[model samples]
Target: MTGCGRREPIVTIDGPAGAGKSSAARELARRLGFRLLDTGAMYRGLAWAVQQAGIPPEDGAPLRDLLERTTVELAGDRVLVNGRDVTAEIRTPAIGELTSVLTALDPVRDKLTPLQRALAAAGGVVLEGRDTGSVVCPDADVKFYLDADIETRARRRRGELAARGVDVGLDRVREEVLRRDRQDMARSLAPLVRPPGAVLVDSTSLGPEAVLRRLLEEVERVRCCTPP
Candidate 1:
């Protein structure tokens, strides 16, 4: 729907892993002339930092402390972890698997919520993450919750990871996806769940083109109605 109360337009695309959130967000951003924010990548950067600092995934205090001294700067597709470019480094399965844990933490969510808000508030933006609509920018003009079957998402994840040269079988990828679902949905602060009034688009049967077309239709309606 239309933005209830905002001077600028913001689109929040939130979904679980491998649900085409990133690709859809990118396409929507280009179509809408909005900046793109891959919030999951931000969490991946935090997970990489925690791992580098020898902090256990469950140690919230240390992870929060480590994050306090670190800065996550998103410069386009480049995710800067403490001023270092580790965008490609954090895409590994090991890092991706651990990132759900980081995103589950209240401390981590507390740290990044402000950053996510500031970026969206600056101007028009299409942000993709678990809680983009629900937590990060609930007041966004359009909220989309993309989804697909676990198997479909797993196959896509396997292809993506393998393309990046991390050879992993589809079976394991399915398991990893299921595990991520549990971890993401069970997370305390900001879980991977739907937001009220969000348009849920299932990509299981629809291709990206169809998804994009439908999304554009929805976004255009919102854009056209937003008060100046």
Candidate 2:
């Protein structure tokens, strides 16, 4: 919510993939009238660009070079890469896998983290990413670590792909989700972790609206406790 002359709250939603962080964050921002920052989409856009250029994910030097020349614009549900809209292109399962690998690299994180921080510098923003609470916005006014069981998470991801007209088997989606989870947790740079003081919400049996309601309650509680 806008604080007028006062400081607006910075909300960080960090979690594993497909745990409803993005959807909940979007709703949370809408209700609060704040900006929504989807950090994952930024990486996914870059992954699409790299893939389009036929660059190998393992090739750090070239990837970094491409990033330097690339202009990634994330605004209003659109992901623009070098002035071209790639919002739909970057949401595929293939780009997601590439994003997982590219995001783990120090060079990529080094380039993107500052951009994310700049976007949130003025506050009144809900940032959703693997390490947003732990690394990107450690001092955020309210932080939430949303999670669900692995099977539930995989199911959610599969449903999303199906809605996009991508016919993927449940077993394959589950295996891929597991693989990405392992990589995210094992990555040396900005690995996923529940930052201290972050509220944990399990959405295994809950819908997006329920999760948003719970998070809004947390925000109200934090606001009440803060000094005016």
Best by lDDT: 2
The positional error of residue 7 in candidate 2, measured at the CA in angstroms, is 1.4
Which pairs of residues clash in candidate 2, taking residues 3 or more apart in a chain or in different chains?
none
Candidate 1: tens digits of C-alpha lDDT, residues 1-228: 245455557888888888998888998898877899988888888989988998888755777678789899899889999899998899997897789877776788788889888888865788989898999888778899999999899999988898888998899999988988998898777778898879999999999999999899988887777777
Using Cα atoms with residue i matched to residue i, what is each candidate's TM-score against the true structure? 0.94, 0.94
| C-alpha lDDT of all candidate models, in order | 0.85, 0.88
After superposition on all C-alphas, the RMSD of every candidate to the true structure, in Å, is: 1.7, 2.3
Clashes of each: 0, 0
Candidate 2 structure quality by residue, lDDT tens digits, 1-228: 333223678899999987998889989999999999999999998899899889888747788789899988886889999999998888898998999999878878888899998998887889998988988888888999999999999999998898888999989999999998998889888888898889999999998888989999998777776666
TM-score between candidate 2 and the true structure? 0.94
State residue 24's C-alpha deviation in candidate 2, in Å. Answer: 0.4
Count of backbone collisions in candidate 2: 0
